[model samples]
Target: MILQPDSKVLIQGITADIASTHGSRMKAYGTNIMAGVNPGSGGQIYHDIPSFDLVEQVVAEIGAIDTTLIFVPAYQALDAALEAIAAGIRQIVIISPGMPPLDMVHLLRKAEATETIIVGPNSPGIIIPGKLLLGTHPSEFYTPGSVGIVSRSSTLTYEIALELTKSGIGQSIGVSIGGDTIAGSSFLQWLQMLDEDENTSAIVLVGEPGGNSEEAAARYIAEAIDKPVIAYIAGRKAPAGRHWGHTGTLAMVVGRGEDVGTAQSKLAAFKSAKVPLAERPAQIPELVKKALK
Candidate 1:
């Protein structure tokens, strides 16, 4: 299941420098953050929340954790994520700004076998307007409505959401699969799930010049989805030989750089699928309204 309001939540690096700020905000936003886990800081309460050394401790005492937000640094992300999965946490969101690509490879392989869902190695996180907050997403920019949002760029995610809200179009859910070239969830995964979501009437997919994720999503949207879908591809003028957000891109890029399709190609893919394309953020709401028609 996607992160829910009632999910027993834990912060793996809750005592870290950045954790307390976002932790407090997430709690204030009404996420059921049940516990905090900082290996050496266990038994010491932080942010007025109980702290534990291990995920199992949270499970044994506070009950099973449904989701975890990891704030550990890039080096520790793999260990922290592995521990959460080992403790039966199904949904893991890595809010770390960077993680070794090889580390992500190992973590993703483990996640696949365990059926764990990883959100980002450098993601802003997920938000359901007027309901739940999971990462660093700006909640004030979002309003509750029927459009479901999925994006690969952090800046564009907020920009697109604010455009919808400004146009009086509220969102059912907004997700940043992160800026990484390789992420846990894909456009196809979120597109499929949002298509099934009862509250979502349409979807806004934000893409950039990267791997063929957009192309794959276009195929799925054309063949499988009955819901109205809108596409917005970023980096229209980016040099075709390069891609943005290189944290994870550099890893897979070596073996499959050619697979990183250009923004022009992505725009073409969505157009070919006959999906409405938004050339700019401001253009999305009108396109969204058209799709929902």
Candidate 2:
């Protein structure tokens, strides 16, 4: 589900301020933004892009759509996603944050059944350096290269990407899976994709404390991934038992003596898997260079 420069994109809820602003930026970046969807705002023009009442309407009038960038309010995000799925959009990126967890569960189920790929419900989206920008990532921090990045924290993703770019280490693709507890995609899923991506020489996995996602990815990398994987787990100094912004960044009890979801636990998982761990965002480029060697 890597968004290519040629991928036709539709902006759901494009009439909204956030969506419209980013839509214009994406268009200026030379993205093939075909249309925007805004129920009653249909037949109107937003930032020079056509608006539609529904994704189906867009498809019927303009033809097939390859991907959808969702910017609807949190409450309407699920509906927009379902509508895109129903309209046969295979790839969708939900940028709105704080969506209800249960709704995401339902959306994930439907997406899985339909073989659709949903990037985030609270994400910064995906960017392929100068090629494509699907979400709200700051493109100036990125440059075309061979390092692929998958992060849970959007801010940290940008920070590390900037470090990489400044250090002359560009990226092949960078995607923020969102910091939510349950995302439509997983670290392992993206890792597998990067493993298969010939353009990606190595992968940088930016994980946050509080969630077995990093642990799970560690186990998978040890067994399945062949590419060199550099990892950095955020919230290293975060207090235990405290809930972070993302649902997945909350500590939980799983077994005796196991501080599941803690930063130490995730770090230990990476250590056990023999994956190099970056002490800080700035240290990531060095680790990436080491891995490439």
Candidate 3:
């Protein structure tokens, strides 16, 4: 998404208990201290931003939230998401993970019931530098430009964006789709939007070791779009059965030393679609530069 100046965001579950990434919190708020939510934190504040106990209370005091980044614990994630939807949050991004499948089912049901857009149950959320940031991803590494980034791993999002910045390629928008299977949105959804975005001249997709999302994305890239694309898949040699993080992190777990190489296989598929694949971090800049050409 191309970030504008008027994007308003609300941060939920901002407390001293799970509050570790104050740096991310600062980067996201930027100059617009819209609002913050924490039940017991009514009088407490972060970065000079006001805090509230409930979503409805915050909405009543500060008006409706345009978007929200949920930082509550896994147990409260579902409730937090539902509250945001009920509070009339147009866009919701859940940064917390470990949410149960049943909770996700409930959240998706609630979101669909209200037509609210959910970004993640286990994600870094979405960010547009100098505009709005939802979730915990750092904004210092990003600058607004032409390429749009969407990834399954928050860490990968930062790593890839840093490489792009070093190559002097900025992004129109960057999103972490979260690692949960029943999470929020998908790569295809973001792809369709970016394809229509005039600001986005190209796209960068970062995929992980498991699931058919990469395959699905590759298929879409092959038939419909003509814009330049670059990609890199992690877990080239991941242990067969080891569940890393994310619900979709593993497809089939076999045995020890029998790591089913996925990153290279996925990259091979992208290569068949004629998308540039970067083997190393340093290669990303060069590859993206060439692809955008």
Worst 10 residues of 1 by lDDT: 243-252
* Every candidate's lDDT: 0.86, 0.90, 0.74
TM-score leader: 2
Model 3 lDDT-worst window of ten: 252-261
Tens-digit lDDT string for candidate 2 (1-293)? 84779889999999998888899989988899999999899889988998988899999988999999999998999999999999989999989888898999899899989999989878999999989999899998999999999999899899999999999999999999987777879998999999999999999999887668899999999999999999998888888777665755433634434378888999999999999999989998998998899
lDDT of 2: 0.90
| TM-scores of all predicted structures | 0.95, 0.97, 0.88
Tell me how far the alpha carbon of residue 157 in candidate 1 is from the true structure, in angstroms, after superposition: 1.0
lDDT tens readout by residue for model 1, 66-143: 889999988999999999999999899998876877888998899999999999878888999888999888899999
Number of clashes recorded per candidate: 0, 1, 0
Cα error, residue 225 of model 1, in Å, equals 0.9
Position 183, candidate 2: lDDT: 83
Q: Which candidate is the best by lDDT?
A: 2
Positional deviation of 17 in candidate 1, in angstroms?
A: 2.7
Please write out the lDDT profile of model 3 over residues 214-274, one tens digit for every residue: 8778889998867777887877666655555565544454332223325655777898888
Rank by lDDT (best first):
2, 1, 3
